[model samples]
Target: MIKAYSISLGALLLGLVLSLVFGSDLAFQRQWQLISGVEPEQFIDFAYLYSLLPRMTMALMVGASLGLVGSLMQQLTQNPLLSPLTMGTSSGAWLALVMLNLWVPLDIADLSAAAAMIGAMFAMFLVIAIVGIRNLSGLPVVLAGMAVNIVLGAVATAIILLNEQFASNLFIWGAGDLEQNDWFWPLWLAPRLLPAILIFLLAPRVLSLLKLGQQGAAARGLNVVPMFLLLSVVGVWLVAASITAVGVISFVGLISPNIARRVGARTTSNELWLSCIIGALLLVFTDLLANALSEQIGDVVHSGIAAALVGAPILIVLCQRQLRAQDQLSLSLPQSRLRWRNRYYGLAAFIIALIALLSLLGQHNAGSWSLAIPDAFNWLLRWPRWLTAVSAGAALAVAGCVLQRLSF
Candidate 1:
């Protein structure tokens, strides 16, 4: 526990130093003095004081809130895959804002929080309704969440596409920019996040009771529904507020608790606290990377995209390292008695290798295809496409095999 916490704190401190160095020319002492209440002498100092500091504070608060909420939800459902993203909060909030901007004449900037919170709550219920209250601790809920996200995300995307001019302001926010102009957002968000205290005080005990199993807890005279509902509502509120403040950053909540578990956080409270620290560290570094890349490429890079890029691979690796049998599938597949043969494997390998070879070397000119090694120019331009096709196909095939194996 000490080692895990030490690592988390070290990473956080390193991230803070890197964040300070990311886009600022100020020396470390000057930056420290500015943050320590020294007066800003120039625009650069003011930028660091307001923009970077508030942005960092927002990142920590939002990330910690997400981590705590995620831990709470996962413990409630006993489902590691549960998070605000999976529960349709992000998409739901996004869709509400989209519709608000589409119809309401008032500034969406002011109305976004209320709309998003409503949408997030509605989406959570929509998921719960689809899966049923009794079936929350299972794959059914996750599938239900996917269905909600797809439908709502599609609707929001279609609206944006159809009315691009009107919804232009929503694009950057949707990408989850952490850029701040001043302390307004930090001050606004800090008060809303105070309910996290309630979560910390109430969650561990309820979650511990829940660990006793629903039937066992009921037998012991515990009313599970009200407690569960309270936690779920608070969790949803935290997530909605988070995305509302920073747009649609995801995966932090989904991955943090898992990392906490991997690092040996056995108790609910320990997991929640550790996940909070890890989540804050993850976002601070991710934001630093985003800002660094923007400087290098001379174009803006949103923290949301950076989080997805970093977190997706980590999630995949986690999935592989811990491929346990989760909640049963809502639907069943037809059982097949047939077994794979060595010849079948050989045939599949040959076909994949042949296609990959041809894809790498084959060129089409004058409406004809021929297999020949491409020049450096062509290879450089097309390798990503080629790699993506070959790798994606193999990945899908492997995933299908794994799904079949796991399902059966």
Candidate 2:
């Protein structure tokens, strides 16, 4: 535990130092002076005090909160793969915020947190209902959560596209920008986190009991349903708080706990604390990296995109490890043909034909429709978009296949 803490703390300090030294155009001495409150100049001090400091603080708080939430969620669901993104909480919160902005004409800053929390809770309840609290195991829960996420994401996308003027800020926010103008976000988020942390500390024993499974927990006199619900609500609140603060930083909750466990955090308490440290360090470092690259990448190097780029590979590797472990205990089954395989191929062919037709012959204006072969330059310009769309569809199909196999 000490070693883990020391390593994470050291890394965090290193990240902070690097960020402070190089994140801005100012010299190291001037940056230190500004950070230390000996105001070098009005603009430099204001920029450092308001933007850089608050952004770093937001990264730490958001990362720690997400880590705590992830640990609690994994314990509650007894599933290592579950997180805010996988459970549809982020999309749900995003959808709710989008609706609020679309419907309400007033400034929404004050109401965003409550709306996000409500949305997260709704998404959680919907997933539970779809999978059933009783049937919370294996592929069904993940599949149900994925289904919910897809639907919510589609709705959110539609809302954004339909109301582009209203959703301009929201679109950037939903991509998880950690750049802050002041300390307001950290100040707002810090107190809300206390209750969730208190609940977590108070429920350690109850959480440990959950590892025994629902039946075993009930056999040991735990009120399985209420306890599960309570933990879940706490988890949802933590996720909502983070989302409200940082605007949907993905996979921190999923990555932190797993990394903590791998690094020798044995007990739940140790795991919780270590995960928090690791998560904070991870996000801070990622944010710093993003800041370093922001000039080159423009807005593409936001924290959420960085997290996904880093986390997705880690997730794939973990899934592969689990797959290997499961493969060892294989039970042979009778070989049988997939009766609908030919139909699946036919469906794919039909979809390809439709895409080609749309790309080559579809009318751009309502008044006139015509089919004509384009010039080489025009065709070359159009082909990339068509190819990208087709590739993305194929990738999604492949992802579904991998997920189905992993679930088994």
How would you encode candidate 1's per-residue C-alpha lDDT over 84-168 as one tens digit per residue?
Answer: 8878888999888888878884876788778888999899889988888877766657678879999998988898889998888
Question: For candidate 2, lDDT tens digit of each residue in 84-183?
Answer: 8778898899888888888874857878778888998898789988877764544446557778888988998898899897687877788888988998
lDDT of each: 0.85, 0.80
Best by lDDT: 1
Q: Which run of 10 residues does model 2 get worst, by summed lDDT? A: 324-333
Clashing residue pairs in candidate 1 are none
Error of 1 at 200 (Å): 0.5
Listed per model in order, the count of residue pairs whose N, CA or C atoms clash below 3 Å is 0, 0
- After superposition, candidate 1 runs with Cα above 4 Å error: 105-110, 318-331, 334-408
The best candidate by TM-score is 2
TM-score of 2: 0.80
